[model samples]
Target: MMTFRDKTVVFNAPKVMGILNVTPDSFSDGGQFNKLDDALKQTEKMIASGATFIDIGGESTRPGATPVTLEEELDRVIPVIDAITERFDTIVSIDTSKSEVMLEAANHGASLINDVRALSQPGALETASRLAQEHNIPTCIMHMQGTPETMQDLPRYNSVVDEVIEFFRAQIERLTANGFEYKQIMLDPGFGFGKTLDHNYEILKRFDEFTQFDLPVLAGMSRKSMIGNLLNKGITERLAGDICVNTVASLAGASILRVHDVGEAADVSKIIEKLNQINV
Candidate 1:
């Protein structure tokens, strides 16, 4: 269980974190929830569908995606964060790499900092450390081979699983040395961020290796090219693929499943819980 201020998220069973990309080009549901009302509506839908957390991203982190200015990212996400926290009782995760955005999101009531850059952006680590001390918020660090722009350009690893484990080790050590408690950290394997299709599947096959950290492992493969490219499907048609991958992830000990399809992912979690309860 992870506690943030007054919110406590129990991970005894995998939890579903709904994706809310409030950008114009996030590969899947971009420009769909940029507006405040639309964002709130989607938040309500996800919550009602059993989302334990709402992950709001301002900047598009898609491969080759253009970068949004800090002010633009703040403008895009803060108001939505404000609205969601005002209306919903769920935990809000700000998906940003900028220190300024993280500060503002925390001030406005975000409980988790889910940085795709894993706090590598300038001042991000310091800012997150301070936030962890001040607000008791947790951070989810993802492993990406390169920047979103160049990440997909022939990304390579000597051994994806071993390399990712090493990266997590270094990050955990760095974060702890910099004043973050172990309980305040989470890990994400970054399904498509900087990986080829084979690399992604390999990580999934070895997903349990991440559980060695004893921290929450987040699996966010909803509507990603990893699935669409593999099945020759479009973004909308990848629900079955998403559920399949998330099921595998849950079985492998993922504590959180970040997904666009919250209802389906929630059902997957329930099924996994029941299966785990089998006595025979």
Candidate 2:
């Protein structure tokens, strides 16, 4: 199984994965951390805020997010990976499903492969499975209905919860048949990729259904279209909405909250976990 020095296993329990999108076109934090020096500073700050994992995304997977080739993706991410691995003693997750990117990241020092495509990119999943076995890296499998270019056109689901559960079951079977251990896997419901506002809310309301598999749930609703589109707000004006979404997600049993604002969300999680301990 994948392990960290601080006993922060990615798949076993709830953990905070702070987002560090080192790309120019990321939905929210693009161009913010693409600089090597800026990325290094942001990563260190995130670690100080109780983040267990640093999820670095070289490509923007936001709905209708433009695509980037493997070369561009690597050029954008490798330096950051090199810089972070050189400095931190924390687990760093590379958020990409491309096999080439995956292999390069494995070589560079990534411990988790958070794939939004769920590795459907022709041998991508299989490659990730093998890499996990080879490098002891855990993988987070997420469900997206369509390509990021067109996922928001007419996203539909008769019963999102059931369909997502089915997807997870099938994905798990695929990985298992490929010789992957269950302990090295995590699950993400992929809240805004191809869902309507209602579908997103439904997934959040029934988040516990995913916990049935006993896998850690990673939620990424921070500053997403689900919050601003629902509230008719802009990306720069969604802090309260983002915080509220994180609060609901944490309460709904999400093991990891992937957020853009690390320090604020870290404080919120601290207070909430404290109250939960009191109740326990």
Candidate 3:
């Protein structure tokens, strides 16, 4: 269980985190909700459908994605976050790697930090630590071999599972050394960040291994290349595949499933939890 200010999210069941990309260039839903009204409408829809958390991202971290200026990123996400918090009562997960952006988003009512880089950016660790201490929110640490601009260039690892475990262990140590607690942190293996199709599937197959750390694990494989490349489907047509991925992750003990299709993911969670409860 993680508490954010006055909000507490208990992972008694698999939680669905709806994705709200407010950028104009995200690989999947870019330009779909760059407008405030559109973004707000989407937020309402996701909340009504049963999303426990809404992840708002400004910059596009898609492969070979162009970098946005600090001011541009702030402009894109802050207002949307403000509107969502004002109109909704769900937890808001800010998907950003910049320290300033994270700090400002927290001020705007961001309840969680979902940094893809895992708070490894220069001032990210300090900023996340301060926010966690001040707001009592949890931070998600993801494992990526390199920057988004070059991560997919030729990602490699002698043993993906072992390497990821090593990375998480080191990162957890660092976070604890710098004033963060084990209970206040989560882990994400970064399915496609710097991995091949085989690597992604391998992580999915062995995701439960991460549970040994005693921290909640998050899996975000929504409409990613891992599914698209494997099924030869476009972004929009990958919903079926995405739901399959979410189901697999949930069965493997994932605490949170970050996804674009909230309703489908909610249904998946319901069915999975029901099956788990049955004596058969």
Which candidate has the top score in TM-score? 1
lDDT of 2 by residue, 113-183 (tens): 89999988877877888886776777889999989999899988889999999999999999988867887
Write out the backbone clash pairs for model 3. Answer: none
- The TM-score that candidate 2 achieves is 0.94
lDDT of model 3, residue 206: 97
* Whole-model lDDT per candidate: 0.94, 0.85, 0.92
Please provide, for model 1 over 60-139, each residue's C-alpha lDDT reduced to its tens digit, 9 standing for 90 to 100. Answer: 99999878899999999999999998888999999999999999999999999999999998999999999999889889
Report the C-alpha displacement of residue 32, candidate 3, in angstroms.
Answer: 0.7
> How close to the true structure is residue 231 of candidate 3, measured as C-alpha lDDT?
97
Q: For each candidate, how many residue pairs have backbone atoms clashing (under 3 Å)?
A: 0, 1, 0
What's the TM-score of each model vs. the native?
0.99, 0.94, 0.98
Q: Order of candidates by lDDT, top first? A: 1, 3, 2
Q: Write the per-residue lDDT of candidate 3 for residues 155-264, one digit (tens) a residue.
A: 99999999999999999999988888788999999998999999999999999999899888999999999999999999889999999999999999998999999999
Our tally of clashes for model 1 stands at: 0
What value does the lDDT take at residue 194 in candidate 1? 86
